[model samples]
Target: MHMKAIQFDSPFNIKIKEYKTPTIGKYSLLVKVAYCGICGTDIHIYEGKVPFVTYPIIPGHEFSGTIKAVGSKVTRFSIGEKVAINPNFSCKDYGYDHHEYCYYCKKNRPHFCINWEAIGVTMNGGFSEFIVCPNTSAFKVPKEVSLKEAALMEPIACCLHGLQQIRIRPENTVLVIGAGPIGLMMVSLIEAFYKSKIIVSEPHPSRRNLAIQFGADIAIDPNNEVLKDVIKKETNNYGVDVSIEAVGGTTTAIEAIDCLNRGGKALLFGVSMPEDTINLNLFELYSKELSLFGSFTNPHENDQALEILKNKLINVSELVSHIFPIWKLEEGLKLMKNKAKDVKKILIQIEDNPKEYSEV
Candidate 1:
């Protein structure tokens, strides 16, 4: 059977085409993709900025869908069940093609695998009517969870991992730089889980308002306001306990490091370019006893993301500001690239059925 798919043919080029649907193999599930979220990496790929991305790729890693068919060996999932994709692909299976685990994988850090092949980055991904992924990458979506919201599980898991990088407590004053979708997710998750005093710094007014609505205790316009003053006043000059850089820029990263307590932890959660560079003060970093770390893709946290979504502990639905059909994916990409003030998360809807058992 033929199905519609969006492909990034080359840099500055994208087109929708009818492609042959993939058949499921043993231990694989044929998923009819319901929704896929347009992420910053997708924008980077479209602009030919993602260093690892190749041309002629179906780029969508954050997605959810229903099982259309299951291979004979796929016993964990059944047909018509909802599932979310875990795009992190481990390329270091010991017995596969005589493969040996890389240093990172050997250290149990597959997120930093030397030969990582993420679904959207290296392999054909979910910007299509159907996809075939191994059962290990599929996490069952609860009946009460909408597939549209379930599509965001990947990002939620990533943010969850980021949160784990820092030791957040109720007394900690947390600051998140940038109020984009990921930053907003950080705010919501921190609010729900840590109950920390949250502050968000965003230049855009709409995003600042959104941060407040999503449980930010304070939202400051970084471009127009003195962010350090706000942080000092909020924390009684102790600075924040933790700072997260989500804007993926050197300035925000510097700001994140600057606005921290003496022994605070900093989580750099943004996706920066290969050429980007940031200058740091090694003396202060040492004198203040600061800890800084980088967070990569989600690692074995999809089930927790599903639990968070299913329990409705965080308001992820509010993060989705726009939804476009699969045919208009190009327009959606443009909206994401332009960073429209109101556009928090842009979703490309392939199939809209939310019921547990239903035909599209």
Candidate 2:
């Protein structure tokens, strides 16, 4: 059987070609893809900015689908089950001939695996009609969760992982830099669970308003209003307890660090350029005892993300502003790359009849 897929042959060169449907191994599952969310990392891959990506690869890491076939050894999941994929893979999953696990993987941190490989980043991904992934990498979707919502599980898991690193308390005041989809997810998570005062810094007017709607107590336009000044005013000059940098830029990262109180914790969850650098004040670090953390990818938080979606704790539906067919993926990519005002979460619909699994 043949399937249509979008392949990135090189930077700025994407093609929609018909390829043979992939067969699964004993530990894998063949899934008919439903929806795939375009991420900022996808843009990096498209622009050839990601150093680890190879040419002629299908680029989609956030996706959900229904299983069409399960390998004989895949007893945990059955055929026809709805599932969301965790794209991160360890050396063993990549068929590496290593007797001992990598240091990071051995410590249960596969996101930093020395020989890490991701489904869409390092291998073929869900920008196609079908995808074959290991059963261990797939998590079943709940009855109430739509495949569209499930497609965002990977990113939501990433946000959850970032939050877990900082351990925000209910009494803490939180500031999230950037009102992008990932930033909004962080706001939603903080709002739903922490009950902390949430502030968002975004330059775009529309995104700032959207952040307010997503439970941000104060949405400041960083282009006009000073973030540190607003942080001081909001916290009565104590600064925020937690700051999350979701916009992958050095400027925003510095803002995240500068707007924190003494003993404050900052989570740098953004994906910055490889060569990006920041100038930090060692005196401030020593005086305030600030803690800065870098979050790579979702380690093992997919299930928690799914549960949040299942209970409708976060407004995932509102985050989806546009949907494009697989053929129009490049168009969607361009819109997202340009930071179009209307773009929030751009979903690429792979199946012609995704509604068929609406009840799944």
Q: Give the least accurate 10-residue stretch of model 1, judged by summed lDDT.
A: 351-360
Q: Model 2 misses residue 132 by how many Å?
A: 1.0
The lDDT of each candidate is 0.87, 0.91
TM-score of each: 0.94, 0.95
Candidate 1's residue-wise lDDT over 167-196, tens digit each? Answer: 799989999999988999999999999888
Name the TM-score of candidate 2.
0.95
Regions more than 4 Å wrong, model 1: 91-103, 352-360
Candidate with the greatest lDDT versus the true structure: 2
- For candidate 2, write residues 1-360 as lDDT tens digits: 999999999999999999999999998999999999999999999999998899989999999999999998878999889999999988656554556878887787888898778988999998999999988789999999999999999999999998999999999999999998899889989999998999999888888888999899999988898889989988899999999999999999999999999999999998999999999999999999999999988988999999999999989998888878887889889988887885688899897834321211
